[model samples]
Target: MSNKKEQLFDIGLFKRLFQFIKPYNLVFSGVFGSVILIAILGVSTPYLLQQAIDTNLTNRVSEGFLFFILLMVGLLFAEFVFQLLFIYYSGWLGQSVVKDIRVKLFNHLLRFKMKYYDNSSVGVLITRSVTDMERIADIFGQGLFMIFRDFLTMIVVSIVMVIMSWKLSLIVFAMLPVVLYATKVFQKYMKTAFEEVRNEVSNLNSFVQERITGMKILQLFAREDVENENFKTINGRHKKGWLKTIWYNSIFFPIPDFCASAVTGLVVWYGGLASVVDGTATQGVLFAFVMFIPKLFRPLRQIADKFNALQMGMVAANRVFKVIDTTSQIDDTGKHIAKNFKGDINFENVFFNYVEDEAVLKGISFNVKAGETVAIVGATGAGKSTIINLLNRFYEIKSGVISIDNFDIKEVTLHSLRSQIAVVLQDVFLFADTILNNITLNNPEITEAQVEQAARDIGVHDFISSLPNGYHYNVKERGVMLSSGQRQLISFLRAYVTNPSILVLDEATSSVDSYSEQLIQNATDKITKGRTSIVIAHRLATIKKADKIIVMDAGNIMEQGTHEELLQIKNGYYKNLYEVQFLKEEVA
Candidate 1:
């Protein structure tokens, strides 16, 4: 939203951008040569016309006229050939550069931490990858080549014009500053307008995408009409931003036309007077000057158009750069290892906050032995999930040490650390992929037998086997093809195949029917036998058999004991929750 003009478009950005084209230098060189040839052919046209006027016409020589006509035809043919070659190479380079840019941007996104995704919207990132990349594509496809071709043509035409008649050339050259100044002013407005268009586009995409994803809630609440109005308001703003950009370009294209006309009128008046009074500048030279003015203005117009495209490209590039430039708060300290993980986790005085000055997890201390099963119970926002997130280093604690097997998690590489921990959340996300791929997502090296075993252990293998394609059956986006219990079962298999040293189940069985829940609970019991497991339960009875159960409130542990021990107290919050759940079950 800030003024883009205030930011320096320095040589460093250019250098980094050009580095992507280094591999295609040969193609670019061919493109460059063709552009130069095209410029030469254009400049030669005016001289050919002048010769036809002065000698071929006045002498009434048929052969000279034929030769002049053939020469013009040949130059025209050559120009067309070069133009074709330029088109081919420019397209090749544009697609190649854009492909590399997208790859780098996506890889950069992977390196960012969970905090980045927590605050950013899916629509904004999608727009950056899709819309912004297309804007940059224009820079390579038309913008860069146009600037090169036109600037060369302009310089060559100007030098030849001056050579033909310095006096007339000076009249035209005097108008150069007018063109430059006008372009400078137009560029400032274009830059701002284009940036506004891009920002608005991002916002509009976010609004539409979020609304579409949340349509279920809207329909449930019967607020479709309200959402539609809200969407119209944001969409109207996008329309206005795009129209302002178009208005700026409408003003931009005319400045060059006005400058060219003013210069041409002056040239004809001055050169015609010199020819009559001094006979110094010939009528043919004056004629060539008139013809050359158009040649100059054509490229001038192209340069202006390219400048406009360049400003938009720069706006997109700046947004992409901003994303790539951000440093993730979590960092690897070069102490990563692929093995020797025993999952002896200890959280010592851990504190955290999603925002500054408001702690979500406050000075909590706990330890899980190498193969202990621990359960955390709390009301919503009581920091049960926050503790698990910190243990996995999804977020770094503000002040504390989380260690696995006596090694602080901060010392391990993110990939190595993550490989040892697996999480199965209440909301399971399944890509539109084969069932086999979903289960083996955590360990691609897993064999068919291992994947099948993991699925069987999680009680999803029978469901998968019932499908026409069995393990190869496709689960559509967000696992829409599967039932909720099936989706949760697949998520369980995804975790189980990793053979993780530690596992965190946050309301993992909350969505399943009682029968499916019992199946998942049986699997959880087997899987946690020798692994350090942490279960955050919404249904208190689910964790009744856990080796240790901790009751929490407002980011603090109110009691730490077994479920039966907490029940015996009969006066705490845990006792109230236990009595309510038992009563509900008995009545059912």
Candidate 2:
């Protein structure tokens, strides 16, 4: 369900991830040194226990006993301090790395073309940014640190164990491979379970987000119960997936301890025999081996858990890479500016398809002079919106050339090209911020005067002033707190504030009441006065006064003329749409 094959992560990916941490090399070095100290302290504690038992308990020297006790206390204190340093710095490194990744991922996401968002789910995107980041950070903050400490402790203890008595050490260490094999086998199942859980969580998140965002529509349509049932079904699936993971953990968590206990029993029995036969293994040595035995199993278990964390991190890393690795289909050369764009647009022999299977715009050729107002009227799926998208460079034309003021759009930087065009589409999106911020989104340098002017021109100035905090009034998410008319007006102001050379209005007035529509239409007239405007809508009243009307059908222009001329034809798409809207007005 990941839609990606599970694969092993190699050094190259980690190296790239490590580059983020390289900037904090000092912190890493501190953590590394502290971990080494902790490992030394851990390995030394068992030897100190041996020294206490052999030198103090056997000798019956009060001074030796006191000295051994004090040394043990001091070493314990040192270990605690080293651990504190290790944890603090490791946590710092993890948090810093998370911050850096989030910033880089966000910046890269912004650079992606529109098509990326079109193909990806919003829920998954948010999850990658938020949930996946935490997983990656945990790998470093907890998993990697555990691996370092446990592995070093295990290594140092192994060397000490062999130096103390190789025969006894071998007996205790024999169970390591069995424990490792068991963990490896169980880890495969855990990974599968975790991946399933992650996928189900993403699905559930997408479902909740989609429904909550459309709650008003669901309620209006009286489908709340239907949506609730659908959500319940999805949530149940997610719960089952998580329960499988819990079941896996319940089995996997206890095996390492069982293996360690079995090894400890073997060590005690074998060391007693060796001591009885030739006094080869002392009681103190057996005590030390007992301590080292538990220490050995501790790292093996940690290694397993850390390995699991690394795998989860890799899964998340793959998603982040998937987003960053995607190449934008809309490639801009970052040059070829139309410095003094007169908005003379030309689409010559243009052909486009959202996908290769079918064409949306076929052999479309047209031109719009500077400062001309062009109204496009067509039936649904007649490629009206596709034309606007092509002009905006949202999608690449399969085979054609679109030029602005004789400069090819593909040859120019998308930023520069888009900076010169302002579009207000039918589905307006408002950020969760104040109304003022939404209006002057692109022009953050806009003065209070400019904001007020744009708001007044769009006829929302009075309504905004009536709000409790005037322009500072919160819009809520997607402007849900305001009426549809208010949202449309704010979107219009946003487009108007830019004052672009070319303006596109795609049914900007379609969903609003007649009064709001008329007010927006008037603002549209003012904004389009000194700029080229392309209006795509079905409402005939909105474009009746346009300088030119383009009537399209099946991706080809059927008529091109003024509204009066198109109406004179009596059989064009424009005439039919006009008749329908006229009848509707009469009925109302």
Candidate 3:
């Protein structure tokens, strides 16, 4: 959807992509050597035929006729060898380039700040990383190099024709302007068409991805018919975008093809006049001209198609580079390391927002002493989760200072800072993988025995062992095979196994049944003991014993005290919130 200013052929795109080939110069040279050798061989084969006919057969010298046939066969065989080299090497280079670029792009995505992802679509990024990358590969394998081969063939063949008979060659050359004009127009239109098609593909991918992910909601509301209609409209636009390129191809291809045929016919008429009527040409030369004209012009039609490919590749590269070139990564210029990181934390006058002038946290200030458990209780939009996000440096604070163990968080490497903390959110996500793998997250240091120990430590070992295949049970995509509570338990097990110095439980018990909640409560008791803990308590009754409790509403802290201390205040915010929750529990 970006206005990247795609050209019929982008020299900058080529130059940029060409750098990927530099790492595999040997393979690239094979393609280069093949193209040149094949070009030379193309001219040689036809030239051999002209020699055999004019020198031997016409002169009635049959001594080396078989030798000429053998030589031509050898030239063809050599051309076959280089053609094989061209295919194998070009294909190898294309895949290698795409692999490198995909890895680089994904790694760049890893470093991007959460703000970029907060505003971007996952489906569009996937299309750029997966689909557009494949198109870029074609630019190397089938698009540019093949076009180069055919072009060199045409150029060499045309020159040979001109040298052989300038008059006949000039007549054939006259048709060239028409073919070039058609190709230019086709390329111009195809660039626009391909760009539109790529845009539609991105839209379709985003739409389908979001719909499928929320298919539960769609069917729950019985909106299938409405969504289906939406799909048809998007798909129709994609079809029309492709049809525009087809329309150009249909009109463009025949022009070069017609020119080839027309030039051949003109060669026959003109060759006859020069050779027979005026004695300016020979039968052998006439035969050579017949062979040369098609070679000179047919590739123009194919170039139009390859140019289409080059344009598509350039368009994809532009989109991909936009992401690769994004400057949204968190600053990692910290010269300090969080040596033996303690969980002591402080925030001074922090001001933040996801959008301009729409602050989510306004000059909020709080602190947690090392090894103490502090609970933050708030309504849905009271900025509980954003605090933890800022703690992890997931987003930058607009105006604030946050420190851990008296060292400013920004003065530590992200890895060093984040390594000391573990978080379990209200919603849990797991990969389509083994239960044990999900728990350890494929950490080589955490063995199956260690995972079992951690699970037992958290009191969820029985639940996991009860499942079929025990530790090896595959959770399936996003842990769909497990119930929501079961997934949350796995998340607990994951966080526990890390043995983090700081632990954050973000409304972790809000969605589970009583039994699951009890199990989580038990895990929470074990994980929080002697560790610095921050709990976003949705159920006010759950945090009575905390060392300190903070109540927040509308991005500001309304109350802060121990449970009994806050209750002693007359009509305090915490007392009212606690009373409301206690009444709700009594009614239920």
Candidate 2 residue 255 C-alpha distance from true site, Å: 1.9
Ranked by lDDT from best down, the candidates are 3, 2, 1
| Most accurate candidate by TM-score | 3
Pairs that collide, model 3: none
Model 1 per-residue lDDT tens digits across residues 472-491: 88897777898887888777
Q: After superposition, which runs of candidate 3 have C-alpha atoms over 4 Å from their true positions? A: 1-7, 586-588
Local lDDT at 283 for model 2:
79
Q: TM-scores for all candidates?
A: 0.91, 0.93, 0.97
Which segments of candidate 1 are over 4 A away from where they belong?
Answer: 1-4, 7-12, 258-287, 334-340, 586-588
Residue-pair clashes per prediction, in order, are 0, 0, 0
In angstroms, the error of model 1 at 58 is 2.3
Query: C-alpha displacement of 34 in model 2, angstroms?
Result: 2.2
| Number of clashes found in candidate 3 | 0
The residue pairs that clash in candidate 1, if any, are none
TM-score of 2: 0.93
Q: How many times do residue backbones clash in model 2?
A: 0
Rank list by TM-score: 3, 2, 1
Q: Mind sharing the TM-score for model 3? A: 0.97
